[model samples]
Target: MTGSIVFDPLIPWPAIAALAVLALAGVVLALWRGLSGWALRGLAALVLLGALAGPAYQVEDRTPLTDIVVMLEDESASQALSDRPDQMTEAAEALAVEIGARANTELRRVTVPDGAGDAGTELMTALTAALAEEPRARIAGIIALSDGQVHDIERAPDLPAPMHLLLTGREDDWDRRLIVRNAPAFAIIGEPVTLTLRIEDSGAVPATGATAPLEISVDGGEAQSFDVPIGQDIDLPLTLPHGGRNVIQFTVPEAEGELTDRNNTALIQMNGVRDRLRVLLVSGEPHPGGRTWRNLLKSDSSVDLVHFTILRPPEKQDGVPVGELSLIAFPTRELFLEKIDDFDLIIFDRYKRRGILPAIYLDNVANYVDKGGAVLIAAGPDFASADSIYRSPLARILPAEPSARVIEDKYRPSVTDLGERHPVTSDLGDGETWGSWLRQIDVTAGAGSVLMSGVEDRPLLILDRVEEGRVALLASDHAWLWNRGYEGGGPQLELLRRLAHWMMKEPELEEEALWAEATGQTMRIIRRSLSEEIGPVTVMRPDGVTLEIELEEVSPGRFEALYDGPEIGLYRLAEGEHEAVIGLGPAAPREFEQTIATGEVLDPVLATMRGGVVRLEDGLPDLRDVREGRPAAGRGWIGLTPRDAYETRDVTQSPLLPAWLVLLLASVLIVGGWLREGRR
Candidate 1:
């Protein structure tokens, strides 16, 4: 309850000012004429003005609002290190108790957890949200208990009152971080690429260890170790061993007295791309399909196509000398014996032996495939003849054996039951209205997967792995009809491209493989196999926890499971003999980027509000109220502003003097002044 003098004016302020001037002029005239009535007249005028002013004693029924103090507790990943969580909890509870016990004060406790992906500690973001939910006038102070490793400082709200930071973690806390300053997303195969990195030590460094052991691993292989100097940048020159994604993990052994070793490891994902894809395309006899292969390889800017057409065979006997015949003799010796390994893929299209390539040269091709090389055989009718290339030494790697029969029936190609799961032909368009093929070399399917079949269910396409290498066989030569838009064409381009890439050992089309991809906290686990159904996948989390999840069939031979990752680190997935390693978030998450706790970032913010930055290590500071812009903190103490906000429920107003009393005073003064003037 409060009482004060207030006015409900009976006359307008402008009117009152005019009346006062006339009264003052009258009194001054009377005084100048030496009349005693001047004093009496002035007193009467004062009473009249007072009555018109409507003065009244007002009493208000007020309810004081409780001042709200927000105590935001940081529970992010960084705060969970060592004993920081315990320290934060203690400080937060103390803050709550202090604020609650204070007269007419309330505590709004807010717990902040880790943010999504690399968002790190969103302390300010959480504070802003809490402030929005409460009244600004009721906010007396904001107190945050954290490790002071905040990531979203720019989002700090405009403090309506004093703000203080009670820092967590001990003064002796230390950490070692592995930093990757620069890493490319793609690198040329066999060419050395430069990667920039460094090692950093924060807080208290180990006295005995000046350097740390660093391990570098690529594609889950054996790791190579080297001692890396602390606080120094390193430029490492390395060559990629294979094509496709190469996941390189760099880790520094944790030193003694470190806060956490999470930041001591970094994962870099880079793609290994060939400078150029060298391909050797040999065509024995010219046909319409020959142009298809030429146009396909030539269209790709990355592929180097070396095409050769044998215009004349040894038994042709055209009565022409070898020198007069054609474009220089086929460099068989240079191609087969000298530099055979230079090419990435070797395609023999409609090739017939006909004594063109000797037995020794064919043996070299087989050996090449045995040494991690790729070969593709596009067989024509000649494949079923006595002069077929199947009669050569290279036949050992062929996925299909010739049956000496050539079928001349019209049949549209269709994907086999097993092809429904194979990546190459699984999603290929239905062949209901596809074009028909005229000729197909009949053969017995060998130890390989049949991706495409023709009339009577004969193998049309076969893919197999030949000891350290890959091989593919296509039985029909009339697939170019699909390219010519016969019966509305088909997915010939896609089919051929996948077949070529699969033979080249593309990782995506591997028959038996496990891999995972991450988007934020969720990971998509993909398992590719030839089996009908796969068992549950066993996932080994970065925190050494194992989880088993069942997979559902998404496509032919492709099984997938969606799992949510709880932490930011590398996850290992295994099913049978297949295993995969995937990093869910950044190589070094933002939470662990600066593990050592300090008050440097928030000190300026606290100073703006005249609040102190106190470390909870010594002790939880005492809470008190201080004037705005004054020192808000002192030794062992913090401060909150006293808002003294209130709500008024009632108001009353009444004239100080009645209208009749003012009239009587004015009448008596008028009578006395008239008498005095009359006497003068």
Candidate 2:
């Protein structure tokens, strides 16, 4: 209980001051005149003033509240590495015992786990939240048992007391990590993209060679090894093999005595995009379907089209001169012989041998197809004639041969059984109610798979692989009828687009492929194949664990399976000859980025509060009591400020002087002063 004197004035303070001033002046005048009752009169006046000035003794009853000490225990994944987990556990138990032994002290244990997803150690975030729950005045100190590699240091709260760190991990701990400094999210195919990387060693690194052996693999293929200098940035130039997502894995062989090999490997997933698609369109004559092919290629801004319509053949004996009829001469030599490789794809729209392009030029075109080139043939009535381009040297590479028969009948196109499994024609929509084609040339498919059929199951579309190139033949010119919305248009644009991209070697449209997509730790593994049944996919995890997962057919050709990966790193998938590599989460998780224990990150915050760091590996320091606003840590001990906080239970107040007692005393003093003056 505590008591203090307080006042409750009956009148205003100004009035009380005026009465006191009057009493003083009267006393002084009486004393100057030699009045005998001046002292008594002054006493009587002081008594009356004291009665009007209300004063009381106030007392309070309080209960002492315990001081709260927040102890943040780091339970992140990094703490589990090495012997840090045991260190953290031992330190926490010792601190709890010490806090409980202190008089009027309480311990608050806050366990901090790994952050959601890729978010690393959130030590400061947990500390801030723990402080917000308790009264600031009642907090004694804060202690964190961690590896001191905090990811959310910016979220540190203002400390009411001191914050000390009990660092885990030994002083001799060291690690080597692979860091990807600069990697583009999307790179153009066939263009050299430079990626910057660094190999860094932290802590007490052993004496080793300056160069480390680094291995790089693309799409789970064979890795190429190189000796790269450590502690320096490396600019690696690479050209993607195919379009779409490309997974590249980089790794360094684990060295002896390193903390872990998790940080020694990194995965980079970049998308391969085409800069531009160059197409050469050679039309035999101006026809209704010729514009369909031209418009389709012209609509895409990425496609660069070189279109030539063979108007006024050399055999036509017109009266007008060739110069008067044509604006410019066709440079067949420049297109077919000189820069044939510059174009990615060449289309023959009803093109025939009209003595325009010589047999040598046609032979060069066939040679172009043999060297990783794509050719699409859209045939019409002229394809069956003796003047057909198939009669030339190009016949060696074409997928189909003309049967010299053109069936003029209404028939809807249908996907063949093999086409149902091919990515190009699979999932095109329901083929039963498609629009009818007016005519289809009879052809014998000899080298390629028939993707579509019409007019009594005759081969209408064929695709083949010729050495390093691809060839596709569409045996009708009536595809424009679908574009014109005949009996409700079919997937004309989609069909042509897929067909063109497939020939150009789009990775997503490959018939035999394997890949994976990640959503958090769950991976959706996909396998595309032409065969009806395929073997189970072999998945090799980052930790060298192998799992064989059987994929179920989700669609006609697409097989998929979901696997929840327990770790984050590069995953290799293989099914027969098809192989793919994908990254589930971060290649190097944030926890493993800096595995060495250090207090540099928490130095600023600790200095502001007069706190220090103590390494648990050196021995847990003793806890001591310290005063507020003084140094809270020393060499052998850490200190906690004693917060003498209390809660008020009750309050009482009593007047110092009663009104009746004051009045009686004033009357006695007045009468005594009158008698003394009368006597004088």
Candidate 3:
């Protein structure tokens, strides 16, 4: 119970102040004039004002509630290393028991976990949230059981009571972490990209050698080791071996006496893009389909096109001089022989053997395709003739052989059964109606799956692989009808784009591939194949745990599965012969970035509240009651501020004097003052 004086005046406070000032002035003037009644007059004025300014006794009936002690337990990944988890558990349980047994005290245990993605441990975030639940005035102190490697210290809230951080690691704790300070997200294939990295050592530095053994590997292959200097930035130059997502893993051999080897390894995922795609377009003569190919290739700013049209054959004998017929001859030697390997893709549009390119040049083109190059053939009615290029050496790699027959009937193209499961032709089945073609060469499908067929189920489009390169054959030259938007048109642009990218070996357009991409903690697994159904995918986690998950057919050629990542590390995905590796969070997760514990982060905050910083490894400290603004810590014990806060169940206030008593006092004082002044 507590009591205080409270005011409930009959008049406003401003008016009362003014009236008191006037009464004081009049008494001072009377005293200075040698008036004998000044003392009585002053006493009378004070009495009258006191009656008007009502004073009451306010009493509060409070039931003392328990003081709150917040115990923040760090359950983040770093805390689980070595014996820290056990240490924290032991200390927390002991603290809970001790706090619960204390008189008028309560314990609030808040478990702090890893933040979203690479945000690390948010100890202050947990503390703020815990504070919000309990009354600020009632919080006696905040006790946290953590490694003290908090990431968001700036978010610490304004604490009302002492905050004590009980450290959770030993003095001998040490750790090593690999940091990738700078890396490009997209790097051009075949071009060297520089990555900046450093090896950071925390806690007690071991007496190891100056140089550490670092290893580098691409796409989960065998690693190559090198000696790199510790505690210094090193620029690593790397060239992507292929297009699309390239997973590069870098690791350093774990040292003895370190906390854990989790930070010694890091995963880097970067995209391999093309600086410029070189395409060679050879046209037998000016035709509408040739224009369509030109337009499609030119649409992409990344493509560098080198087109050549054979306007006149060498065999044609015109009665004109060579200089009059042409100003510059086509550089066949420069393009087809010397720099053939420089091109990524080569297209022959309705081209036949016109003696424009020698037989040796044709052989070189076939060899080019054999040595990891792309080629496409668009045959016309002339392909079935005697002078067809199919009779040349290039026929060895072409997928289809044209018979001596030409189908001149109007036919609409349709995707084959196998095409439905191939990425290049998979999306062609968006249910859009394609225009009709008037001319198509009758061909016999030899090697490769027929993706599309024209009239009477004959092969229209066939794709195959020759050596290390890719080949595609289209049996019609009137595909430009779709580009002209005839009969509502079809996905001519889209189909052509897919075919071109597939020939270039784009990973997304591959018919068979296994890949995984992660967002937050969930990984989207994609499996593409030409088979009707894909088998189960074998997933290898960073902890060497293998999981077999069955994939569901999301579309014709695509199978998808969403798996929540168990932790942040490199995840390996394998489906039969296809394999892929993806990094989940950062190379070294934020939780593992700093594993050693210290009190340098929150020491200032603890000092501001006059709190203690103790280590659980030394044993849970004894809790003691201390006054606010005093040192709440000793050598083997910590202290808490006993707020003695409670809820006021009842409140009563009464005027010190009753209304009649106040009136009687005021009348006597005024009468006494008037009679004394009249005598003076």
Strongest candidate by lDDT:
2
Model 3 alpha-carbon drift over 4 Å, by segment: 17-46, 429-432, 663-680
The better-scoring model by lDDT among 1 and 3 is: 3
- The alpha-carbon root-mean-square deviation between model 3 and the true structure, to one decimal in Å, is 2.6
Residues 1-680 of candidate 2: C-alpha lDDT, one tens digit per residue:
98999888899999999999999999999999998999999999888888778888999998999999999999998889889999999889998998999899999999999999979999888988888899999999999999899999998889999999999999999989999999999999999999999999999999978989999999778899999999999999999887899899999999999998888888889999999999999999999899999999999999999998998788888688656764588899999999999999999999999989999999998899999999999999999999998999999999999999988999999999999999899989999778999999999999988999999999999999999999999999999999999988798889999999998898889998889999989999999888889999999997899999999999888999999998888788998988888888886789999999999999999988899999998898988889988898999799999999999999999887788788788889999988999997
User: Could you list the CA RMSD of all candidates, in the order they appear?
Assistant: 2.5, 3.4, 2.6
lDDT per residue for candidate 3 within 1-680, as digits (tens), equals 88999888889989889989999998999889887777777777777677678888999998889898888999988899989989998888888888989998888889899887678899998899888888898999889888898999999999989888899889888888789988899999999999998988888887887789899999888999999999999999999998999999999888998999988888888999999999999999899999999999999999999999888777778788876865478899999999999999999999989888989999999999999999999899778999898999998999888888999998888898888888877767554467787888999998998998889999999999999999999999988898888887788888889999999998888888889878977899999888877789999988899999999988887899999988777888888889888888767777887788988988978888888788887877888889988989999889999998888988899888777876777677667777877886
lDDT of each: 0.86, 0.92, 0.88
Model 3 steric clash pairs: none
Clashing residue pairs for model 1: 421-556, 421-557
Q: State the lDDT of candidate 1 residue by residue for 1-680, as single tens digits.
A: 89888876789988888899999998999889788779888888988888788877878899999999998889998888998888887777776776778999999999999886578899899999999999998898988898888888888789898888888888888888999999999999899999999999889776746677999988667899998778899999978887777788898877777888899889888889888888899998889888888888898898899997877777887688767855777798899888889988999999998787889988998999999889999999889989899999988999999999999998889998888888888777777877788889999987788989997999999998899888999998988888999878888888888888887777787878888887877999999988998999999887899989999988778889899998766788889998878877787788888988888988777888888788888888887778877888899998888889999988765556767877888889878777876786
Listed in order, each prediction's TM-score against the native is 0.93, 0.88, 0.93
Candidate 2, lDDT over the whole model: 0.92
- Once fitted onto the true fold, the runs of candidate 2 whose alpha carbons sit more than 4 angstroms away are 6-54, 322-339, 358-371, 391-403, 407-422, 426-437, 444-459, 482-490, 530-535, 658-680
lDDT of 1 at 511: 79
Model 2 TM-score?
Answer: 0.88
Residue 325 in model 2: lDDT: 66
